[model samples]
Target: MEFMEVIRKRRSIRKFKPEPVPDELIMELLEAARLAPSGTNLQPWRFIIIKSEEKRRELLGHTVNFVVTAPVVIACCVDLNTYKQHKPQRIKELTRAGAFSGVDLNFNDGDKYWKQRGALNANEIREYVSINCAVAVQQLVLRATDLGLGTCWVMMFDQDSVKKILGLGADIDVLALIPVGYADQDPAPRPRLPVRELLIKELK
Candidate 1:
């Protein structure tokens, strides 16, 4: 599908058919995410894909009915271990690459902006960590749309339970739950702000 058409047609699909998403197509979607940009190239997204019937059923209430019904559910996660492991290298890279051609990069910009919360707590760091995963999630959904699959980005799940269910270690955090499958209903386009209203200013 054309890029714009794919973007326009993508919806937060809730109801899904019973067919499973093909592995080949799933890899293609993940490939889109693998190419997403990240701060200091610190790609921290970790995907935990759930396809087993028992697992999905177990996640039903913790997540939503969609998890039980959709053929696939992906747990989008952020790896604190990866961040810690690569921190030194990423700081060097970010500082060396800099913000732009002229602007110097303060690699510790994260420190400055976030440290005000007293000792740079996990909550503050979570904001930056989630960006990498969020970008990947966007890519996954767009690719899913192009493949004629439907997806819903879910965040209302019990986070701790999801972590336990996935057997994730302390180094990982659940960022989102995406249920993917064939759409059962054709939802109408949602309302949106007009182009002019959305734009702050348009360059000539």
Candidate 2:
């Protein structure tokens, strides 16, 4: 599908057929996410592919019960440690690649331009990591749609409980739940704000 057609056809699929999505296709979706751009290549996104009925049932306790009906529910996660561990090296790498041309690389004074990840509070750090992870999630969903799979981003869940259910450590945080499978319904496009209303300002 053309990119715009994929965007237009994409819907928040709630109902899913019993047909299983192939593992090869799932890998393609993951590859799309892997190629998503990240902040200074921090690449904090990690995923838990929940394919078993038992685990889906367990997650249904926290997320919408309908989510369990799908054959796969991906637990999209953000590894906070990625930023903490790779910040310096990524900055150096970016410097070498001329991402910040004409700027001197500094090991002291926290590099002045690069904000210190360590300075962020617990909530700030999570939000920071989640933003990067969301980019990857969007790419994955778009890829899934192009491959004739259905998906819904489920966020109205008990994050702490879901985290425990997935056996993720403190450094990893579940950002969203994506249930992927064959579509059981062809949903109408949800309402969207007009482009005029969406733009704060338009310059010639």
What lDDT score belongs to each candidate, Candidate 1 first?
0.82, 0.88
| lDDT tens digits by residue: candidate 2, 84-105 | 7988899788777767765345
Instruction: Report the error of model 1 at residue 106, Å.
Output: 4.9
The best candidate in terms of TM-score: 2
* lDDT of candidate 1 over 1-204, digit per residue (tens): 999999999999999999878889888878988898886578989898888989888897787776678998888899976666776677566657653234234334644332343443576567777977899889989999999999988998998898998999888999999998999989999999999898998789
lDDT of 2 at 4: 96
Q: Which ten-residue region of model 2 has the weakest summed lDDT? A: 102-111
* Candidate 1 clashing pairs, residues 3+ apart or interchain: none
Q: Which pairs clash in model 2? A: none
> Which candidate gets the maximum lDDT versus the true structure?
2
Candidate 1 stretches with Cα past 4 Å from truth are: 94-119, 200-204
lDDT at residue 96 of model 1 (Cα atoms): 70
